[model samples]
Target: MSSISIRKAVLSDLETLLELEQGVIKAERPLDPFLGKGELNYYNIPEMISNKNTHLLVAIVNNEVVASGYVRVENSKIYHKNVKHGYIGFMFVKENFRGQRISNLILDSLKNWAKENSLKELRLDVYSNNTGAIKAYERFGFTKSLVNMRTEI
Candidate 1:
């Protein structure tokens, strides 16, 4: 494993981020009912990286983004206790980059950012079927605090 540098994403990294997002969507298609057939909007990359309340982190290998994750501050009535909390989302590590501890580094970067922003808690929602991701979060000290159900209309 080469040295993987994790950094905050900028507008210049949009294209690479979009590619990463698409890769994750494709990988999850078999297990995720919400992921349908379509390409992700590459134009939204700028917004995703620059959103004032969001933190986008990327792991770069040889100047290319191979892994990415995001943290957003949202006000929630229940899980957040009506206060601002950090929510992790859009986490992805390129297939070839797995087992290198890159995801853990990205997560640590996000957690550091959350702490710097004075967030009291961090939360995330993983698909019930994504046991791998659930286990990863569990290893990071995340507990099952809530159960969510969905109804397809």
Candidate 2:
């Protein structure tokens, strides 16, 4: 098997990253009912790449971008002890690349970046029914801390 390497995403990586973002939305639409039907965007790639508070990363294999994710620095809630934390999102690994622990590598790098920035906590939101993703994050040492509830008004 070819080795996987993780690197910071650049503006040139935008095309592949956009497709990967669609992949994520496609996989998640069934798990979420509130998503819009056409051309939905969950992130701003160029701004993210240029933002000092965000770290966008892509996973490369055999000179191709196959997976992508990002972590952004966010202010903690006023009640929280820490002033800031890393908010992880857009974690999508291509279908062909699943089960290879590439996500773990991405998480490790993001965690390191957060620590280097003196952020004491890392947090992310996962679909409540996405058991596979939940298990993966659990295996990576993340504990369940919140469950956002919603209903039709």
Relative to the unseen true structure, what is the C-alpha lDDT of residue 72 in candidate 1, on a scale of 0 to 100? 90
- List where candidate 2 sits over 4 angstroms from the true fold: none
Residue-wise lDDT of candidate 2 within 34-138, one digit each (tens)? 998998989989999999999999999999998888899999989999989999999999999998999999999999999999999999999999999999999
Q: Compute each candidate's TM-score over C-alphas.
A: 0.89, 0.98
Provide the lDDT at 85 for model 1.
87
Q: Residue 37 in model 2: shift from native, Å?
A: 1.2
Candidate 2 pairs with clashing backbones: none
lDDT of 2: 0.94
- Model 1: residues >4 Å from true position, as ranges? 40-43, 78-82
Q: Evaluated with TM-score, which candidate comes out highest?
A: 2
Pairs with backbone N, CA or C atoms under 3 Å apart (clashes), candidate 1: none
